[model samples]
Target: WTIAQVKAVAQAYGESAAMLLDGLDSGEPVGALAAKMQEAVFYVGDAEYRCLADIGERAHDVSGLEFVALREGSRWKVYPVESAPGGDYFVVEQILIRPRDAPESSPVIAIVDDDPLLTAEMCSYFHSHGYIARPYNTEATFRAALGENVFDGFIVDWLLETGTAEAIIQSIRQSRHGDAPILLLTGKLVTGEANEDEVARVIQQYDVKPFEKPAR
Candidate 1:
């Protein structure tokens, strides 16, 4: 097979592998990864082969990526291969993995905010979409909860009742739960004294996704 054929084969395999992921929406990025996996081609003999095991072998910048072997009824399929370790993969975590050997559990998100109404809204939204949301009303409570539980993601209010968002973030990064994704919610102009420069700095420093308040 020519390079195009080899790549096409890889693409087909990769997308199928990605689709095996559980709990993720698996957006339009479905085919791109398998195409990328093909990019790591290694030639062997006349028939050609793509090493499915080596798709994301050297990733360091990658986050949130996981591979799982799924068995539904009589079917069995694995992503990035069961042979690969979590340490071998890097970059952005593109897969939702729930290994067949491991017991399945719903993903959880930690929502930190001072407003009861906002926290309730956020929790309700996530719960409706299959995730379990844990809402904290203050920085102290958030930090305390972090010590006792693990979360898949975080949504923090930039302005809290008892602490500043910057301080809360800094403390979070210093904790064991820092590796989780952190998203910020603040008005476009923000409250307190945080100017655009300060807000931008916080976003960059912590690698957070910021959601400015919607216009009324």
Candidate 2:
């Protein structure tokens, strides 16, 4: 198969693997989800191939076939059947899909702001642009999520309803996401609600990018 065909097959396999994992993560039974797998058709270059899903049964069939390794997301490895030795090489018997150790390709951005509207808007914008943006209306919720999920970056409002975001920012800087990008949003600077010197010191110490709101 040509390079384009190879890419097309890889894309299809990745998507399928992601959907399967999603199903399993959502409490779906493994056997029930596996049974729903259908033959994936790939139009590579000027040719077409119907690739069957092998859920442990057809392992021997793909033993001799040339396998094309495709990495899907950070957790899964997909080996799609590329070419067979005998007749009807285009129509492969099975495609092997498995898990792999890797970081997530999709960036998970944390949007921490007290304003629910702004948080929602930021999350929506990031989602529209192909990112996994999670919104938090309070520091508590954000901290709770921080313990459960690994975020790629942070967009935090400096002034929350009850307190400042300095503690939250400090926690992030000292944590595993120390090198992650952090955008500090604050309308307090313009409104004279916070000390400019303290804000600047925090920004410098934490190595955070400060943005005065309303952000465009």
Worst 10 residues of 2 by lDDT: 69-78
| Whole-model lDDT, model 2 | 0.68
Q: Write the per-residue lDDT of candidate 2 for residues 57-122, one digit (tens) a residue.
A: 333345565443232332212243653223222223345243322337779999998888888989
Candidate 1 per-residue C-alpha lDDT over 1-216 given as tens digits, one digit per residue, 9 for 90 to 100: 475665676687775433344445545464555555322222223332223322334445433455433333432233443344343333322333322222127788998888888888889767644578988997878878988887778888776766458988887787887887888888736454546777789999998888887511
RMSD of each: 17.5, 17.8
Candidate 1: where are CA atoms >4 Å away?
Answer: 1-104, 188-193
TM-score of each: 0.49, 0.53
* Cα lDDT over the full model 1: 0.62
